[model samples]
Target: MAEMIVLKGLIKRFGDLLAVDDISLDVKRGEVLGFLGPNGAGKSTTMKMIAGFLTPTAGTATVCGHEVTEQPVEVKKRIGYLPEGAPTYGDMTPATFLDFIAEIRGFTGTERTKRVDAVVETVDIKEVLCQRIETLSKGFKRRVGLAQSMLHDPEVLILDEPTDGLDPNQKHHVRNLIRDMAANKAIIISTHILEEVEAVCSRAVVIGHGRLLADGTAEDLMARLPYHNAVAVRVTQDNLSIVQEGLSALGPVEAVAEAGGLTRLRVAADDGKARLADVAGLIQDKGLAVREVFVERGRMDDAFRDITKGETMESLHQGDGNA
Candidate 1:
């Protein structure tokens, strides 16, 4: 696939703070790449650089082959950006705001009118088109923002927290819009919602503290973390120490907990399918009544927590000169 967006050794700094470290990444044409990171992890900084809103202190970025710094206007022309808060002209109606954006994007005359109307309808904001943006609900306002970003029909879209304040129905609608747009445009969605990543993004890149941590498909990322095939077993019992000890005797157990008359154990092994059967067999042989045994599949949330927690702990230790 062709690369629509590329960052080479990208770096951004604010005095003593390095907002974005040297990072290189690529977004393929017609692909939705989820950019995920904890707060202050440089996700927004990276997106800003890509959108030509901020110049990288060092390194370079390209949008549709145009260097973001050297040809910012050209890059901006080919890309649509929706910032973190989805800011809009509060005083202007959806129709007015979109028309303003269309003018700035160089749309004119009948072309501009048609484009504005198309986007307003595409976002399903017809009823709220004439209402002041401030009067519209958060969800409707977000739709207006989305419509403006897409008015020019840019080939690349950079959306930061696109569904931040949207309701469930609106979120679903926006997700569908993004998926539909991915057929013809390269999109980068920066959000903390793990389920959204799984739902809309074909690939994901995880960042932490101004550095890239992991990049791959959801399944691939889950496999990279330890305990990918582990399973959690819960048994109804007052005391889990004995049960934990018994389970540990079989193989390596990751965790054990007992609360509210339920004992939970996480077992780790090379073959999860076989390990589950072994565990059940052992529990039966030991004459313990097993309440439930189920495989626990690794989720994106678990992987994100592990990566960010490790990064946080490492950063603290580094500051303390411990590592």
Candidate 2:
């Protein structure tokens, strides 16, 4: 199942508005790809196209060598999709719901019971298995959705906000589940949660304005941060000017927020890799008494905003000009 998921110049439009635009990517088995973007950035729409729920306006998507439009059933059979909101049959219990799903997927007898039990335990939904879905809490409902998605053990998983309603313990459990299954499946998780991408996904694909903005390992995306791997130095208020001036010779120095009798500054690395010893040496060379000096890891939250926000602003400007 290597390269099980592929998208080539995929585009989706709802009338005059373009939802996904010219996005091309491939997901290999053993790779957990984080589908990241702000709301309405077309993450769901693109996933839908690949899942064969929505046909693309142009281009194509394929799952396991089956072009979605040409072989829709083949594609669906290989995919385990948990759409947003985790919609379920309000009248049915989780037990019945999963049984129905197992039957639909052609599992029967002891094998069907075995699969249902496995996913129910995996998702920690034993207590709520017989409760009507509409009567369950949001978290329970979501877990039921997850259980159904995995009951068939599909080769590819397209999870949209899989942990949206779970508590911390449940979230942790599900993250572990995803990691455990990642070795044999091509998984694409669409979530606004940045930490999930770091913890679960092996690589990340960021989309903005319906375009593929960045695609790389989680660390690679974090490197896009302006202060990624920059050195942070804290000096007394009196030494702030002297310290920043000395550090600027090494690279750009970012002025950090001032605090009580102290000022922290970040020395930007010219090549995005700054060492702590470099900053330490500078402080020592000046014989300055600095309270703290350390290297700052790239902040993922800031990087996400910068990537998506910058493109959104740019697109707005372009629209304004056209108008």
- Candidate 1 residue-wise lDDT, 189-257, digit = tens: 999999899889998887888987777776666665456667667866653666677788777665555
Q: Which stretches of candidate 1 lie over 4 Å from their true place?
A: 238-250, 269-288, 311-323
**Total clashes in model 1, counting residue pairs 3 or more apart in sequence or in different chains:** 0
Alpha-carbon lDDT of model 1: 0.83
| lDDT, model 2, position 172 | 90
C-alpha TM-scores of all predictions? 0.85, 0.90
The regions of model 2 sitting more than 4 angstroms off are 235-252, 258-262, 284-287, 311-323
Top TM-score model? 2
User: Taking the tens digit of each residue's C-alpha lDDT, what string does model 2 give over 1-323?
Assistant: 57899899999999999999999899999999999889999999998898899999999898999999999999999999998899889899999999999999999999999999999889988998888999999999999999988989999999999999889988998999999999999999998989999999999877887987777888977766767888888888778888888887777788776668777788876677786777788778877677888887788788688778774334433423211
